[model samples]
Target: MPEISRFLGMIIAMYYDDHAPPHFHVRYGDREAVIRINDLACIQGNLPPKAMGLVIEWAMAHKEELEKDWALARQDLPLNKIAPLE
Candidate 1:
């Protein structure tokens, strides 16, 4: 997994050659979720409401960057570091 961003104690990352629907991984403490880049849906796992809210806000702000990172991840190329939520 390659970490692309982190903020407010949340770690955002993507795996090389990962599964479809173009998503990224988010980990905060013991909670984790796989968030789809297209629609910001939670495909798997779970997070606290506040944490999830932050994740959604951050994802909404960086959807384009997330898509680009997904493409790079699929190609196993270096992923760009996205700006974290302030």
Candidate 2:
């Protein structure tokens, strides 16, 4: 997994494993969730309440970049650098 962004101690990463969708994994402490790229919604697992809120907010703010990165990742190409979110 390559970390692409971080916020509120929640790390957003891309995982390269067969069968995994083009999504980002959010991790905070022991909590984790796989957020789908197409919809920017949590598809699997759970995250801490505050972490989840922050993740959702951050994802929404960076949806465009996130989707673009996901596409590049799916093609096994180098990811585009995303600007840091406030």
Candidate 3:
């Protein structure tokens, strides 16, 4: 997995040539989740409430970038780094 953003101890990443539905991986401490890019839904895994909220807020702000990165990742190209939530 390639990390594209990090904030408040949360790490956001995506895998190259990953599975369908366009999503990103988020890791906070030992918890993690796969959030779908389109609707910002947690398709897999789990996170704490505050962490999940921050993830959603950050994802909403960088949804477009996430989509673009997903496309790049599908091609196995280097992904662009997105700004972390302040």
Highest lDDT, which number?
3
Clash-forming residue pairs, model 1: none
The stretch of ten residues in a row with the least summed lDDT in candidate 2 is 14-23
**Which should have the higher lDDT, number 1 or number 3?**
3
The C-alpha RMSD in Å for every predicted model, in order, reads 0.6, 1.9, 0.6
Candidate 3, residue 7: lDDT? 95
TM-score winner between candidates 1 and 2: 1
lDDT of 3 by residue, 2-81 (tens): 99999999999999978999999999999989999999999999999999999999999999999999999988899999
* Error of model 3, residue 27, in angstroms: 0.5
Across 1-86, the per-residue lDDT of candidate 2 in tens digits comes to 77888766778888655255667888888878998866767888998777777787787888888878877777888776555457
Model 3 alpha-carbon drift over 4 Å, by segment: none
Quickly count the clashes in candidate 3.
Answer: 0
Sequence-dependent TM-score of model 3 = 0.97
Whole-model lDDT values for every prediction: 0.94, 0.76, 0.95
Candidate 2 regions with alpha-carbon error over 4 angstroms: 17-21
Please give the RMSD of candidate 2 to the true structure. Answer: 1.9
